[model samples]
Target: MRDWFVASRVSAGFIVVLVGYTSSAVIVFQAAAAAGASEQQISSWLWALGVGMGLSSIGLSWYSKKPILTAWSTPGAALLVTSLQGLSINEAIGAFLFSSLLITLSGLSGFIDKLIRWIPQSLASAMLAGVLLQFSLQLFSALESQLILVVAMIACYLIGRHIAPRYVMLLTLLVGCGVAYQLGLLDLSSVSFQLAKPEWVSPDFSWQALIGVGLPLFVVTMASQNMPGIAALHGNGYRPAISPIIAWTGVTGLVLAPFGGFAFNLSAITASICMGKEADSDPSKRYLASIWAGIFYIAIGLLGATVVSLFAAFPQELVTAVAGLALLSTIANSLAGALADAEGREAAICTFLLTASSVSFFGIGSAFWGLSLGMLVHYFTQAVSKKKQLMKT
Candidate 1:
């Protein structure tokens, strides 16, 4: 039983890494290309990011005894695709360093900590639910193309959950892979055994690069990534001094910035996999998932091209389905948390809908806007109710 439990936790970690890298790695590549990186430099970029996320996720999860997974800022990567177009690789590196420094200072100042504390729990959960809703919908929407593969994986997941809940995700993943392979959907020709060559480029700072790329990168990463990450931790009942963890990620960014590690922040969507009962019936053991994810991150860093090619072989629909099924429980739990309190229900629901809409403004994602709007609704409603009671009395 103990061995089986350990296996489940381990599988959860892999799922987090799998979903994370395959989902946004293309954007990271585009960001690197925009900086005019050579093939070797692009390999270095992946190596730095993979290792940075691995070390931070493992160290933070182990130290905090919580499933605190770190990820490269997807939005930050997208920002770089356009922002770094005219910048030298050295200038791009400078922008990366500047953004990381600001992130570190934000953590040290405890401003972000205060902001997170001000958010209602219901709204936090609502934001999480909203963020994950798209992935869940993708699971079924995939039926249009890979109907047999999707149906088979879903059927397997449902039955496995009833008979062996701990193995459901693992079972679903294996089923998806097996069926996809049988259909010749996987492209295994690119599989190779080679290491990603790491190259270092010293940064040359300029005001234009710093303000245009650095400052905006900092804003988007903090608002779009770290906030939701902390909310995931809180929503799942894991609180371990998020302020310091945020600082640590910034510190990691500072260290790896020159090597092409643009941004490192807490993971919002993927972290839920490790936090839930699917990882371990005992929440305490779920930290192992992050630890394993860290180990995989390091391996992928060392063999960036090789391992990534292996993940790339899996069909897009397969990745989408597995991610949705793995997140099902987390999504359900988040919804329950969001609506659990009558006083905060309106605020939470609004937050959920806005976040699910995938809205963005000023380069900031919907997660931030949803939380902000929800906070306003909650406080305004409470104040109006108080005023009406006073008048009646």
Candidate 2:
């Protein structure tokens, strides 16, 4: 029993990584409202996304024997928050279906897979590093508002890294909670236990929603999040079938979209956590960790508010600090890979800077634009270099 519990706990680490990547509750609420969903409808949305992600993770990870994760699109969530300002709930669902269908088609048609092949590895790595750098900076910035909480978390993370590197995030969370309790920063009295129930909103498709919200959400999620996620998998020495995974996520999202599942895609940062040696010494055994994560996610989905409230009770700074520290290794590796190749240096640097800048143009985030520009520069430079060499010859 003791050994079994230990195994279970290790499995739970996958869910921890997922939660650490982006607390679902915080983002889901904002995402639902942005899509003009009501309170009840938003709860349903959580149910949809949670179940979708959980099931996809389980099935894909099991079949491929790799750590395949499915997550609600962070980029899509962000897009909805900005674009769903005045849209009706039905229209938003319409947008959801539209984008999902397009995603499915893209996966089936092999266009996205082809596109992924064309990108330089350095540029992809640079884009990933840039996207994550913002979160790392924010971890520190959060300290200004909650110094004691952040400091406690940082101290715990350092100590934990030395003692039990595999469970560093878990240890930091535990120690941070203890400090928060001692400092009287924690409020447990408000915590409540409640299951989340799915509430279905009738589908209403609108051209406006399709063009304005659906298309952009699809584009950004694929470009900014999924692309780098796949790149991370390849970078880390796991190459699974891309089209099937993409197709599966789209199908899951489509089935659950009416219930509040927005966009589901591959996870880069959290997946890496489970994929690493810390999870297990053997790469073949890592899938079990992801399977365990899926189980925990399913439980959270069923428990709903109870689980969300528990995480919400933690001081924000604690979450930020721990997340930042946990990702330090990954960030360093990504940066190293991005700058390693001499030929790709200029283009990779452009990608990194542009993504790090966080600029937005025409409602699109910098991640996509940065990668686009980088690829362009890389291709152009290669062409010119080849031309010059031929002339000299």
Best by TM-score: 1
lDDT tens digits by residue: candidate 1, 271-376: 9998888888889888888888888899999998888888888899999998999889999999999999988899999999999999889889999999999999
- Which regions in candidate 2 have their CA more than 4 angstroms from the true location? 1-24, 34-36
Instruction: Itemize residue pairs with steric clashes in candidate 1.
Output: none
Please give me the total number of clashing residue pairs in predicted model 2.
2
lDDT of 1 at 130: 96
Positional deviation of residue 256's Cα in model 2 after best superposition, in angstroms: 0.9
Model 2 scores a TM of 0.90
Across residues 196-293, which tens digit of lDDT does each residue of candidate 2 receive? 79987777887888899999988887876788778667666677879878988888878888887778888876776666655665777777777777
lDDT agreement of model 2 with the native: 0.76
TM-score, each model? 0.98, 0.90
Local distance difference test values of all predictions, in order:
0.92, 0.76
- lDDT winner among the candidates? 1
- How many backbone clashes does every candidate have? 0, 2
